[model samples]
Target: MIEKKSITFLYRTYKKHWPLLLLALFGSILESASMAGLAYLIKDVVDDVFVEKSYEKLIVITSVLIGIAVGKQVGFFLKNYLYPVVIYRALREMRAKIYNRILRAKPSVYRKETSGDIISRATTDVERFGEISSTIGTNIITETFTVIGIIGVLLYRDWKMFMIFAFTVPVLAFALQYFGEKRKKYSKRLQESFSQYIQHLNQIVSGIEVVKLFHEKVFFRYFNRINSDLFKRQKKNRFYETVYLSSVEIVAYIATAGIIFYGGIRIIKGEITAGDFFSFLGGVLILVNSLQTLQRGAINLKALTPVVERIKYVLNLPVEDDKGKDFKGLKESIRYKNVTVKIGESVLLKNINLKIKKGEKLGIVGATGSGKSTLVKILPALITEYTGEVLIDNVELRGYSVFSLREKVGMVSQEVFIFNDTLRNNLLIAKPDATDEELIQALKKAKADFVFRLENGLDTVLGEKGSRLSGGERQRISIARIFLKNPDIIIFDEATSALDVETEEYIMEEIGKYFKDKTALIITHRLKLLEITDRIVVMENGKIIEEGTKEELIKKKGVFYRFSVISSS
Candidate 1:
């Protein structure tokens, strides 16, 4: 049995297609009614034609049978066609909503979920949820009506035989409930195992090079463990499903045998004609088949309980907070006062105080995991949960709408992500309405003039993740986006680290010229990149240990001086 909450969710998902649902129901009713008509007419054919050998009556009965067949075909066509239309349309809407929610969900949610687990919910779990609709359409509507019509015929032919068949209902119902619960338990385990299988596969694909270099045996062992688990869970799930169906079939067979035995006794006593007994048998067979289908549908619904819960989890994830005043342009300064950030027990950033005036270039350098990236990320509202305060133009950072605030900041990170599209299309993500000439100009500014040499120029299809482009070329493409955005503040989070020395020098020269009058924050380990900054902050273990102009820090012979000496050597 489906839980009450699952029923409510499915109703809300499918209620918009009620017109098609009603039409499908009408077709189901017609189809079942046609079956009953055929069974009822079986008596006429057996008695009038087979027994009486009346040619006229035989012709009339044949005509009526032909009409029933035609009606049944029409109903079959309507139910088959309309039910899919309703189901698939609802599924399409559900996929879109899931994607939208994932895109807008908070960063914390991403941390909590693996990409593989999320993908499993969106794809596999959703497809399984569709079984609920199938059960409703096929088992609930069609089979239920078919059982009722056939039972009506059975009662009319011989109420005593119908009574015999009725004795099996309580036993069948109990079996269905018991087996359905067992199937549901295995189904949940099967889905979880599948999720882990997907996650393991994703890890292997993403780290194929690492596996090839050092840990091939280790990764393979992990894969084998996950795969074996998945196989075992799937085997168990199938076993339970088969057992449930077999139990239902056994009960149906017993009921059929009981009816046959009682009907034979009645016919011998002359209580019913041969034609009447056979007609009742035909109705009983149809009813048994319908009940089996209804039981299968119920079991499928029970299996869908876990799938429904998984989908609901994704849809209910918290969306990013976007409610605040729209940020214009920064006029004065960006300041951090006693700011701290933590995730679980890990302190990513501690109480830090820093300030930079508009149009001033600031440099931040720290060892790995010293909170360099985390500090810069706070400016774009990507990490919003922090104590103390971040002020932009003397207003609280949260006071500005996250979207509007992001529009004013341009960040070029070391890990450049290039979509598998033409260079022109990839560049247009920064400024969607930019013209061809504007794109060419931005590429030139970022020293990414290689696009002009490609066979199709901007129309070239970059393979997945820009496979056709070299590291420097990909970095140039990212820089081109920043040039296109032309925001008030520019952030270089080791953005040129992937480029060759010559390419890095050239790109930095171009960037220096473009950002001369703009407020800028440069986060890099390379000491040379600090040449353009008016001031520098040195961080160690989530704290700002030193702050001064480049020359002043070098004069102090502190952490910055040590870093400078190491770079120079």
Candidate 2:
């Protein structure tokens, strides 16, 4: 469970207008006062006109009743409309805070958590908070204050009944608060279970191709189990709620019965008139109903505490580590010292040391399962909290902010992804301000000319992740984009591995030309690409085994040369 501080912090992060909440309280008082006044008027009409046979005050009584009605409606309108405005604004503020937290979360956080869990919290959890925020306040404020007002009026009219009612009411509150504890725990579990269900659903949907190929309906058993659990929890919650509601109704019924019996005795003894008893019974219903709603609202407030805490957990997560305050670019080198990248118990890259000079085209080659990708992942400052230092331009990597570090480096992964937009729009992402001539120049540089021959030149809409294009086309577009952006440093994660011999060769020339002086880090199995690179770094078992220029390493026939010879052969 998230701590109390987190929930309180989120609540404080977006404050509601105290004036509005107070106004909601005020409107409720007016509305309840009007209602309570009606009962008094009825008592007066009966006692003064019916029993006393006085017709002179009838016109004044009628006007007073109409005025109460109008005032109640007006009070209701103000409370209903204005209070929701505050609720909506609070919701918007919370959603924004959660989104910013997500944006700045550490990479370690994402690798451990699921996209679906995060998305569910942002969408469903926040929406529930909004609904909770809107309703809980009105119920707690209006119902509670109204009930108090009725009790005060009753106490003034006849202290004995009010005292008895107070004694019984606490028992109902205790029952609700008791049940409320259980509800809060289960509500948290329900959200957690739903998160799990969402996480598993994401895994299944993403791997649907595997499921279909294997024809495995058995794989869906887990989902079935989750659904059953959710159903059971929901039923239990409903049952507990029903018990609380039944108790509240019983309290109302018993109070009514007691009022009838006691008021009748008083009337018979002539201590209180029949007219006052009639008005008292009506007031009793209004007061008890208000208390009932307030009791239920208290339970709901308890139930929503977990959601508020969950939202706060995400919203209050420390914004990702600040990039250093240093302003120097990576003109000299970016060096790593005894760096260890660990994900919880397992380390991805361990005890590594390396450096890349400015204008250095560094090729990082390793066998599959080696930490080649992890090593490059560090340069972009993607994975921090490693064992050692990553320094750029003589300043510690920690000294640079994420904005400064990422702004200077652009990464192109082996897996190509394009937005569902026009080809031109996708390429324009490289340089949003780049001219058409500049864009075409970049496209040609990255060997992306073939895309122009398509029906929509640059305006053509690409389907989801460029599903509209072939694998080679997507790869070329990514390359063209990197070329256009022209960041100071580039990390190519097997960027050319998806291409065939012909496309690879054309891109090899264009890629080398475009990234001539930029600090380039290439993670690839194709060590033969080292021919065009200025330096080569070999990694094995998360350790830097060797480093040298291609020709220099080839003559030695070390690991780089061996892979090179095999790839060539």
Best model number under lDDT: 1
For each candidate, the alpha-carbon lDDT, in order, equals 0.87, 0.77
Provide the lDDT at 535 for model 1. 97
Q: Output the number of the TM-score-best candidate.
A: 1
Candidate 2 stretches greater than 4 Å from native: 1-16, 48-59, 106-125, 174-207, 219-244, 303-309, 320-347, 350-355, 387-395, 399-402, 415-430, 436-474, 551-558, 565-569
Per-residue lDDT over 376-418 for candidate 1, one digit per residue giving the tens place of the 0 to 100 score: 9999888877999999988999899888988999899988888
**TM-score on alpha carbons, each prediction:** 0.91, 0.83
lDDT of 2 by residue, 1-569 (tens): 33476457545744557777677767877887887787667777888778987767777787888999998987787677767777777778777888888988887678877887788788877887776665655676677667766766676666776676667777767766676666667776787777778888888887887878974667667778888888888887777767767866776788778878887888898888877777777777787777667766655555476776677678766677664584435778888888888777777787888878898888888788678888887767787758888878777877777877777788998777689998878888778888888888878877776877879777889987787777777888898888888888989898887788777878877778777877888887775566677888888888888888888888888887888888878
Write down the TM-score for model 1.
Answer: 0.91
Candidate 2 displacement at residue 48 in angstroms: 4.7
Misplaced by over 4 Å in model 1 are: 172-206, 215-250, 303-305
Model 1 residue 155 lDDT score: 89
